[model samples]
Target: GNEYPEDLAALPPQIIIGAQYVQAAGVALGFKKKGAKNVAYTYTGDGGTSQGDFYEGINFAGAYQAPAIFVVQNNGYAISVPRAVQTAAPTLAQKGLAAGIPGIQVDGMDALAVYLVMSEARKYSVEGNGPVLIETLTYRFGPHTLSGDDPHRYRTADEEAEWEKKDPLVRLRTYLDEKGLWSEEQEEAYIEEVNEQINEAMKKTEQAPKQKVSEYLQNVFVETPPTLEEQIAKFAAKEEA
Candidate 1:
């Protein structure tokens, strides 16, 4: 969400995530003022954490005792950039200590571990213990997005193969299989069910009417400003001409 205000002076305290460190911290500060018992959680990749805003957000949260959980998903690489080039810091969690907030590094591949740690952190915040920084050491198996390719240029095949062995899905499946909770039939059925659900969602999305250009202008203000009205008139005149 675009939490940044049009006037920089009007910016609220938040916890900026991903590439939005400043904005997220602004939202977190807002939560602090609202007397929130639970911490406002914001996630950011390793690369994004390198930005000034990330550190600033953490510092502010700690200073004000804002209920904020800063989660760093260290997936080894930020798009094409490897972690080696990202930061010299040995651990992302260590960065939190500078802000006087406890930082915990957890095995991101273990779903239960992450859940438990986060749950405990939430409890600590609710009890007026302040913010916690959690660095989840995970891996991104797929491309950064549909547009990007496997980041093999900076990463070695051996490294990729090693991390693949520790894949969260594979580990979880293995654990379930050991407990007799997973079988070939069950796996197939689960895949089929998920595929059907995804296909239905896609169909609905595709069938939905596309947003018009005018819709963008409508949300910019509660009522059109004089400048916006003039621009709209000019746009209409151009269309007519």
Candidate 2:
């Protein structure tokens, strides 16, 4: 079932957060209360660190020694706001220090490093050491979203170029090539295979039945927001017609 994505027995995601940043703390604590063996993780932006929920969640997780991982994607900018304006802290990872959680900073551009740190963080959480915080130092290669956000308003060309050099794909490919493990032929074949799979999935999606509003709510989260309650009722009525 869609509700049981992946191995439901291994990881049952009971809580789905809405727009409220406070939900992070509440959800993680809920999972801990249930005596879950797996770690619960939540992600927020650099700007989101200012949200009271971010602090509340970390504190709660630390207090109970909940298996929660707080992931902060410091993508340089929180939408239009720059990181410098967000906080004067030496590093975002250190924010967890106040909550009694250990912090690990990693090069967001280095995929291997990010994986290793996250792996260690998860192990720490499962070991009941409490939640660990990970601050991946990355850049927003594009606008915050597909919206009318333009990075040109704040960032300069040189800055973008600097990060561009640290592209995870390039670095990984370069390292693999140096070890005679990658080549242009291999890349082309892999790209072709991935594109074929993506296209097939898109075709399936397009041919699938038109989803009711209620189904949309079930897709990403189990909890429905108050605003969506009315919409869900209306969709149910329309679907019955």
Candidate 3:
């Protein structure tokens, strides 16, 4: 899912932390060179701002005046570490100042606000303005991952309850309902449609063939290295056995 093979414009995000920022700048520069109006955008957590690549990427984009957007989802935590512990910057958006790019912060919980901000940012960038840094004030409801994190360990239930009140889905649905645009029946039907689609996708996934260890090893190299050749042989032998 990290790699969207079907979408050519959707580059696979780098696994190395903060690497996508620089990649996006490069993509934006490529578009500019081709005289295209397209802009490149990438996202990272508040914690990712600490990485050296973040500064380098933004700085490069700034100096070259490449059309790019860097979004920081300041969910208040980077895994187990709180945002306060990450940096002393008054606001993450201000980090763009050092790179000579425009920076702004918006209410991450309000979907409409985010949409408006992104619209303006896209317009600014595509119109020859360099990169923009946007910090979205948000919160995480559950563990960073379902694996080892426990929100209760670091954040208070009171804080969680406060954020739950600002849930974007809830706010958006309320606004739609107020405008007489959404109804319970429509919501129910949409939910059923989504459930069916998810079920079908899961069924297809369950029926997919399993990949072998040998296949993974072989795919890693075009001309297999001697070390990998030995590994492939050992795994293939074990698998055949």
**How do the residues 134-211 of candidate 3 rate in per-residue lDDT, one tens digit apiece?**
999999889988898888999999999999999999999999999999999999999999999999999998997776
Local error of candidate 1 at 48, Å? 1.0
Clashing residue pairs for model 2: none
Provide the lowest-lDDT 10-residue window in model 2: 1-10
Q: How far in Å is the alpha carbon of 24 misplaced in model 2?
A: 4.7
* Candidate 2 local lDDT, 149-218, one digit each (tens): 9999989999999999999989999999999999999999999999999999999989977656666554
Best by lDDT: 3
Please give, for residues 26-133, the per-residue lDDT of candidate 1 as tens digits.
556666565554356778888778788888888877887777788999998888888888888899999999999999999999988999999999888657777889
* Model 3 pairs in collision: none
Please list the residue runs of candidate 2 whose C-alpha ends up more than 4 Å from where it truly belongs after superposition: 1-27, 30-35, 196-241
Q: After superposition, how far is residue 162 of candidate 2 from its true place, in Å?
A: 1.4
Candidate ordering by TM-score (highest first): 3, 2, 1
lDDT of each: 0.77, 0.76, 0.87
Against the hidden true structure, what lDDT does model 2 obtain? 0.76
Residue 7 shift from truth in candidate 3, angstroms: 11
Per-candidate TM equals 0.70, 0.73, 0.78
